[model samples]
Target: MASGKHRDNIKQQSKAAAKKSGNSIASRISNSFRNHQQVAVDSLDRLLASISGTLMIWIMIAIAMALPLFLLLFLQNLQQFGSDLDEASQISVFMNTTTEMPRLEQLRDELLGRSEIQNVEIISAETALQEFQASSGFGDILSGLDENPLPPVLLVTPLAQDAAVLQPLLASLQDYPEVDEVQFDLDWLQRLYGILNLAQRLTYMIGLLLALGVALVVGNTIKLAIENRRDEIVVVKLVGGTDAYVSRPFLYTGLWYGAGGGLIACVLILLAQLILQGPVSRLAGLYEGEFALVGLGISGFFMVLLLSAMLGWFGAWLSVLRHLRAIEPG
Candidate 1:
């Protein structure tokens, strides 16, 4: 009976000890989180205390971030405009002046039936002459001609914009007896594509350089901050504070700077878009284009904020690791 009682007592003690251990672990985790939270809040308060200096840093970072962002937005809009032009691209097939209306209609139908062609629009000789007269502002001279000078034309929209496909199609059209000339102006289209590609490359290069600039700016700011708080860091270390504990506030400070800069950059970009909207609309109107300026939507906005915060954190981390090691309590 005594042996059984002793076994029961041992089991109860083990259960109690396990419970106490679990509670201790939970308490430690809670304390760690609370400490981090307090540190982060305190860091932000310090930044707020010197609003002028903080604002200056934020503006510098924002300008650096905004330059690349603006270039990217411009490139996106330009690409969209280029796509619009690409979709409207067509081959002009001028028929022989002697070609009859019936032959022109038949040729258009045949071109439309081809797998490579998406659409074919026929402009009768008389209609072409009238359009030319209206556009050229030489209506009197054109009307005095005994016979219509313009030939019937077919505007052929191809299914594919690839040069390989378009070149063959152009050659085939030229072989047709009714075709006086097949003009696709492939060179201009190719040049447009080349220009867009070059622009994209330039944007990427500029974005990379600007991103580096942002990181450097943050790092330099953090370095200055470390210098200002040199005595505080040395005191903390002397009191047996861990490196992480000493560095937590600075890390948070960097994060605040980056996040603030990101926010300011967003504002700048929006303002720029608004300022340019009217001019862009008017210009597009002049070109008979229905293009509208696009801004960083919700996803892009959040992404910028996140990226800026990351850069700030990285800069702070680098600064802390480099400078904290050199400071000794002795």
Candidate 2:
């Protein structure tokens, strides 16, 4: 009888212990959820506590991001113009007025036979005179002249529009005795492309510097936050809070800072684009160009936000890791 009673008592204790364990697990989960929620609320409160200072930092970050973005957009537009110019590449070779007709014919045949020359159009002096008269609306002024002042010319298109190929061909053509002058219409295109390349490098350098600046800003802010909550951290440590628990709030704070700055930067970029769109469109129209100003579409918008958030998170993590170890229960 005693043995049976003892077995029953053990079973009862086992059931009670199981229930206690379950309650403990439930309590822990509830506490964790509450802590997370509180951390988020505190971070938001911190942001709201210093609205003016936060705005100033956000604006500084926005300007830093905007300058590079503007330069990149300018480079894009310049590249478009260079692409158009390249497709229409042509060299004008003007013959000496005294060059014989047979020599001119020989030169044209030679250019046509070369593999580098894609197409050639020969414009006679008389034909050029007639075109000028028709296009210039100066028929009356030209009718008084007895002789056409224009020289015979050849408009030559190359198989390659690159400077490497065209430059050599231009030099070779100038060596010809019948050639008076060779007008390279694409020199400015090369120059503009070179400038764009330099500008792209400058933009990259500037972006790197600004990214470092952002990291520094976030780190410093997180460090100050740590200092402000020093006693609370010490108390939490005394009560057996883990390092992860102590660091969560600061990490959230960094994320908030980064996200806010990214949003402001995007706003600045869009505003600048809006202000410049009309002028850019008008300028393109003047050149008969099919060009339009572009902005950070959906992909770019997400990218900016994601990058900023990562920077903020990393900065906060660094600060927390370095400083959390210094705070102890003692």
Candidate 3:
């Protein structure tokens, strides 16, 4: 009778333990869902409050990005213009006046074998005078002057378009015994290249300074938010809230700030670009150029957005950690 009673007691104990386990699991799941909802609500509320500041953040980012973008585009156009001018970057290689036309023709033929040189226009004295008269619109003045003073020249164009490479090539061509002076308008292109490099370096330096400024701005803002909610933080501590629970909302707030600011920056940049587009097009048309500036593509847009959000999050996290520890007991 006692053995049977013992078996029944064991069964009852097992049933009670199973029921307790099931209840605990249900309670945990309910609490987990509730916490998720609470965190979501908290994050959303903070994000709304932060919109105005976030807008300012994005505007700053936009300005920083836009300056570099415009400068880069202008530099690209400058390089393109140099390339276009390359067709005309021809060197006027004047032959030694003593060299006969036949010998000059022989020399031209010999030069034709060189792969580095583009097309060569052999301008005889009469042809040079004629071209100068036509281009200068000085036909009437030239008709009055009985003497034709222009010399025979070979307009030598290099196949390569870069100013750096062209100068060395010109030096090599000038070494020829039959060649006198080699004249080329290489100054403008060289200066343009130099200016472009300087501008790029300046933009990079400014960008670094501005990025640091952004991080500071975010940090200060988070610090202020933390200060404002001192009592609320105290209440959370009294209510047995874990540090992670208190910190999650602020972390979310930072994420939102970065993402929102990044968005605003992108919008501002596009708006600025749109505003400038008409004037740019008109200017390009005046120069008879088909060049069009490119804006940031989809990948670039996403990258900027991601970076902004990340920065904001990091700044907020840094502030929260520094302050949260100070709030707790030693």
All candidates: TM-score: 0.69, 0.65, 0.63
Task: Give a tens-digit lDDT track for model 2, residues 65-182.
Answer: 6777778877887787677767787899999887666777788889999888998888888888899999999988898998777899988988876677777999999999889999
Q: What is the TM-score of candidate 1?
A: 0.69
Give the worst 10-residue stretch by lDDT in candidate 2: 17-26
Winner by TM-score between candidate 3 and candidate 2: 2
Give the per-residue lDDT of model 3 (tens digit) for 126-167.
888888988999888997987776768988877876666776
What are the root-mean-square deviations of the candidates from the true structure over C-alphas? 7.5, 9.1, 9.4
| Model 3 TM-score, 2 decimals | 0.63
Q: In order, what lDDT does every prediction score?
A: 0.88, 0.84, 0.75
lDDT value, candidate 3, whole model: 0.75
Q: Candidate 1: what lDDT? A: 0.88
**Poorest lDDT segment (10 consecutive residues) of candidate 3:** 61-70
Cα lDDT for residue 207, candidate 2: 87
Regions more than 4 Å wrong, model 2? 1-41, 90-184
